[model samples]
Target: SQQGEEDPQALSIQEGENATMNCSYKTSINNLQWYRQNSGRGLVHLILIRSNEREKHSGRLRVTLDTSKKSSSLLITASRAADTASYFCATDAYTSGTYKYIFGTGTRLKVLA
Candidate 1:
């Protein structure tokens, strides 16, 4: 499958703490992206790291990619209660002359106030 798998399916942390999530995929990809989703809502694109990029950051979010390991990690620094959400990793794969996205199961994060 082209889908990635996220580790530590769930996480709980206090406000101001940091949360980290990891994802691993089975196939080569052009890029990997991280997304956040509130309950009963659609995903919010957070960051994208291309295969040639080792790391990228936006606001308090940090993303890392390791093509050699087919893995990626997302870190949210100084998290807030509002940061509580499900995080997912998606990869862009070209198959059968079409581009398809495979999303990981997701990591549920809970930030306590």
Candidate 2:
């Protein structure tokens, strides 16, 4: 399992602040994706970055990947209480001759109002 692990297992910040999370994996991946889950709801795809790309942005979200370091980071700017949720990093990697999508232990973020 090439499952990644998110740093700072939990985070808390005031609304309107910025939040950042980091993920590290053990294997090579073709691409990395970030997902957000609101409470018990399903995961919502936020951003994806291929190994060939260094950084990508969508709205208030920014994602950066460093294949050489087998790591990735997600940043949310001007975060709101509505942004309080669990953030996960998934990786698509070819392992044991099979391509697999693996998710990491998520980071629980709390944006206090």
Candidate 3:
């Protein structure tokens, strides 16, 4: 599979703290996108940075891409309890037509109040 795998299946942090997670994939990709899923909620798009880009930030979240190494990292600063959720990395292999994103197994993050 051309999917990525995230380290540390789960994480716990206090409110107003920071959280970091890493992902590694097997295939080359055009872009990578980060998503958040709160419990039973749908996945919400967080940010997406293309292969040519090294880093991108959205609000309190920051994402770094290293295409040469087939790896990516996500950093959330000053995390709040509300930030508790599962985070996933989805990648599109720069393919045409039928190809879709392959999502990582995800990292479950718990932010303590």
Assess each prediction's global lDDT (C-alpha) against the native: 0.94, 0.93, 0.91
lDDT per residue for candidate 3 within 1-113, as digits (tens), equals: 63989877999999989999989998888899999999968999999999999999999999999998999999999999889999999998545666689999999999999
Per-residue CA lDDT of model 2 for 1-113, tens digit only, reads: 53899988999999999999999998888899999999879999999999999999999999999999999999999999999999999998685989877999999999999
State the local distance difference test value for candidate 2.
0.93
RMSD of each: 1.2, 1.7, 1.4
Q: Please provide, for model 1 over 1-113, each residue's C-alpha lDDT reduced to its tens digit, 9 standing for 90 to 100.
A: 53899987999999999999999998889999999999959999899999999999999999999999999999999999999999999999897999878999999999999
Q: Rank candidates by lDDT, best first.
A: 1, 2, 3
Candidate 3 residues lying further than 4 Å off, grouped into runs, are 94-96
Candidate 1: worst 10 consecutive residues by lDDT?
1-10
Task: Give each model a TM-score.
Answer: 0.95, 0.93, 0.93
C-alpha RMSD of candidate 1: 1.2
Each candidate structure's count of clashing pairs: 0, 0, 0
